[model samples]
Target chain A: MMIDFSLYVITNRDLSRNKTIIEVVEEVIQGGATIIQIREKNLPTRIFFENAQTIGKITKKAGIPLIINDRLDIALAVDANGVHLGDEDLPLKYARKVAPHLIIGYSAGSICEARKAEEDGADYLGVGSVFSTKTKIDAGEAIGAKKLEEIKRAVSIPVVAIGGITLVNLPEVIQSGVDGVAVVSSIIGAESPFQATKKFRFTIDYLRKGKIC
Target chain B: MMIDFSLYVITNRDLSRNKTIIEVVEEVIQGGATIIQIREKNLPTRIFFENAQTIGKITKKAGIPLIINDRLDIALAVDANGVHLGDEDLPLKYARKVAPHLIIGYSAGSICEARKAEEDGADYLGVGSVFSTKTKIDAGEAIGAKKLEEIKRAVSIPVVAIGGITLVNLPEVIQSGVDGVAVVSSIIGAESPFQATKKFRFTIDYLRKGKIC
Candidate 1:
């Protein structure tokens, strides 16, 4: 599947909060997220699968491909659009072999990793914790705007700035040379996810027009 | 969860001839494969998940932990013991945070990866494609027994030898110091997965005891 180069949103799989991953996913998709990823941490397999399948069905229905974070099985199970691998995940080439047509993405920690992911045929790179994020307990501090510039200059694929990226900093992230932004709390924990995603979409639209959203 | 240091087997997902994953997994479990990983590289995700869910139930029922070869989502869904992250899968540390108690394993391409896997907090390492096998197409030639030895010496966690491991080459793989063996065609692709696993179980038992099984 060709990746949606616009905006990518990382879905939170906390069944308790999400209650219904598909329901919540539908709302996010409606908010204009082109790509969906299920990044649920620590839950029984039963819970994750049920949630993945539910969300997968919703994302598929929306014509937006759902990507599983880290788990190939869940992605395969839910027939996700593809997978997003972190610096710690499997290499792109091998993952491609596992699911030849999968839209494989890699997280680049260093410029070298970003370049290597491109060399390894990664469809895209999720490149940063642009700002501190509460999603992860110990995310390496922001990889820095300069690091993003170096990585962007080094590769030709889409690079989405992650880690604490939000509407407030969307302008800065885009100026840093990222193709898009990846958000968690900005959408997951937002008062209104729909407005949040639309706000992000507007931000990117403005940026392309040589302004800020 | 603590790993079953005794023996682990890798195989093409048993969804095909076995009809459902549960049946295939139960048969192998009976033969003493403590860990079962689904590595169905060529199938579609929908079919793969159907099969994985079936086997996941079986493994969960039998008290055996099922592992998804390279996908973290499937593992999360089935809550099979953990995930076997190929060099191409997500990094082990993030995987650990996602499934804090889940056994996070890694494929080691070099001592550097193993060291990082450990510091990043990996549970174990699948050291090599012990020998070349048709089961694993285009796999880099076996890292030979030496790479396994070097990895074993370098890491403190238990190591499982992978790739082309089989009964005939069992001795050499075990001698290399890996804690267990993960195989493919040697069992699942064989005419009698039952006998194949028995042979592997016996071989591993003998090797671990430094005697004949």
Candidate 2:
């Protein structure tokens, strides 16, 4: 299964406001989200599993991959397309051993972590808090495009820029040579998730074409 | 906060059947479950968080502590009483650093792991698949009461025996000096979760008196 790294939306319930996560996700998908990751840090296990199953069906129908954030059991339980692990979550090698068929993405804060993730058989890397992020208070200081570029060059696997990614700064992130961008508040917290997603999709595509030229 | 590890019920959604996880959990709590860990391995992040919040409320009102299995983020988000982590989940030391007030339990397969978990500030240790559990296919072989005893001896912290524990084997596990027993299928899978929990609680208390005598 080829996993698309473009326009990946990681869900945050706190950012979704009054809308349910499913509602936000569906809108984003309609607006051309290439991939969806359920990154909620607060839901209880059963609800999380049910949501994954629900979202998995939607993402499957849309022909886009759904990745469960942090929990491997949920990914396997929902038969999700993949799982995304943070630096503190399960190690990539062990996660790979347990779920060989699942696409695994690891959060990388530095070149060392990125290289190790690639060596450990991660399918892709979510590298950042590229700018200070409200989504995760302790995500650390912004790594900036310079370090993101360094990480991109250091690892063989695709790197997705995350944390504080927005339309205003996305062109520079794309210029930094990241394979994709992961958004949280900017999309899910928007007045219209669909419009926000569409704007991001357009910007990403435009930048990629410019890079190719 | 002092956590009562006695009658720790780790939930499995697959085993819960017709009732919701909250319904099953509430039933078990009423039947004398001391600690409740929402161990649904398949829930999506939002659902897991919401479930934890809901269950946390229930557990709190009853004065029974709630532990979220594996995800520290969810545990913190829901203000859960604690978190239970396997060898594959977050490291105990880091989890402690992040959530100093939360009660942390680590699953230990060996004496070394058990001791390390204690040193790393784990509130308790969950040892086994002591009877070969179908619940965790990869839980490996049953470590038996003998290893459970050895782990108990090796670790200064409280030990909770888990995996395939039932009314039949409850006496033997109790004899092994476990501070508590963590159950999945034996309770949640039973026809009446409340009755199953009552039976386990009664046996545990009876065994404790026997040990005291």
Report, for candidate 2, the interface RMSD.
11.5
Model 1 alpha-carbon drift over 4 Å, by segment:
A15-19, A137-139, B1-213
Q: Ten consecutive residues with minimal summed lDDT in candidate 2 chain A? A: A86-95
**What would the per-residue lDDT of candidate 2 be over residues A107-131, giving only the tens digit for each residue?**
8888998898888899999998799
TM-score per prediction, in order, is 0.52, 0.55
DockQ of 2: 0.04
Tens-digit per-residue lDDT, B47-164, candidate 2: 6767777898998899888888887767765677888886656666656765687788888888988888898899888899789888972256799999999999998889999888
Local accuracy of candidate 1 as per-residue lDDT tens digits, A1-213:
666656888877552254455666777788889888888765544467677777877777788877788666556656678888764454456566656777887887678888888888888888876777778612366777777778888899888778887767777778877777777778877766777788888777788787543
Every candidate's TM-score, chain A alone: 0.89, 0.95
Model 1 over residues B1-213: C-alpha lDDT tens digits?
556855676656532364344555666788889788877664533455566777877777777777777667555654567777755455465566656777888777568877888887888887766677666522456788888799889999888887777778788888887888887667776666777788889878888887743
| DockQ result, candidate 1 | 0.07
Candidate 2 regions with alpha-carbon error over 4 angstroms: A211-213, B1-213
Calculate DockQ per candidate and list them.
Answer: 0.07, 0.04
Candidates' C-alpha lDDT: 0.72, 0.84
> Which has the greatest TM-score?
2
